[model samples]
Target: MAYSHVSKKNGVAYYLHARVTPTANGTRTMYFFAKEVKAGDDVTKALDEVPAGYIVVESDATGLPLLKKG
Candidate 1:
């Protein structure tokens, strides 16, 4: 199952996703949250667990989920 976080302010659920992009130096992975999982999404893939040394946080103003280092 995909890792999900519910916002305390809005009660909206967000699923964690990881996106990989190629750079000049090398490839980098970025973590993000979305409401729904996209079909045929090659660049972004849903994460089953939170990455090590990271935690999820929600915005107080918008209730959007964010990844923070822990």
Candidate 2:
């Protein structure tokens, strides 16, 4: 299953989505979500509000939570 990374930049929240290219090396592409969460937003609560069949993961680089498909 694919996963989406959630990150906060300048007090705003964004989502990074991974896209795989049909290339010989299978290059991966990252994209940002169209929506943004305002500052002071509860990230943990947002994670918990995710619907079923999805899981939250921590980003190794940012230590932020990411949403992934189960």
Candidate 3:
């Protein structure tokens, strides 16, 4: 499962997702969600609210979350 972290910038809350890649070298990457959420929000619940048509994937090299058009 993917996990998310909440960060605030310029009064806006960003949901960052971390995902692990399945490559020979385990890599992790951080992806920024398209929208800003409320502060102190739950990461897991925020993930479920990701906008439609977008999917979270892992980067082969960095193992970070990659936001892609799906």
Candidate 4:
């Protein structure tokens, strides 16, 4: 199952997704969350857990989830 985060304020479930892109410096992996999984999203790229050294936080105003490097 996709990693999920429940918004404390809104109580909405958000599923985590990841995408990898090639850059001049190197490959970069981007992480995000959505209410539903997209069709083109790779199953392998969808994270099953919070990434190591990272923490999830909520926006104070919007209550949207965010990933923070810990």
Q: Which model is ahead, 2 or 3, in terms of lDDT? A: 3
With a 3 Å backbone cut-off (N, CA, C), the pairs that clash in candidate 2 are: none
Q: Write the per-residue lDDT of candidate 1 for residues 1-70, one digit (tens) a residue.
A: 8899999989988999999999999999999999986553878899999999998888888999999999
TM-score, each model?
A: 0.91, 0.33, 0.37, 0.85
Residue 58 lDDT (model 1): 86
Q: Order the candidates by lDDT, highest first — what do you get? A: 1, 4, 3, 2
What is the C-alpha lDDT profile of model 2 across 1-70, one tens digit per residue?
2223444433334443433345577664332232343232222112214446766665667666665788
lDDT of 1 at 9: 88
Candidate 2 runs further than 4 Å off: 1-48
Clashes in candidate 1: how many? 0
lDDT of 1 at 26: 96
For 1-70, candidate 4 gives per-residue lDDT tens digits of 8789999989999888888888999888888988886556443266789999999999999888999999
lDDT of 4 at 6: 94
Instruction: Order candidates by TM-score, high to low.
Output: 1, 4, 3, 2
User: What are the runs in model 4 whose C-alpha is more than 4 Å off?
Assistant: 40-44
Query: Which candidate tops TM-score?
Result: 1
Report the candidate with higher TM-score, 2 versus 4: 4
The global Cα lDDT (0 to 1) of model 3 is 0.45
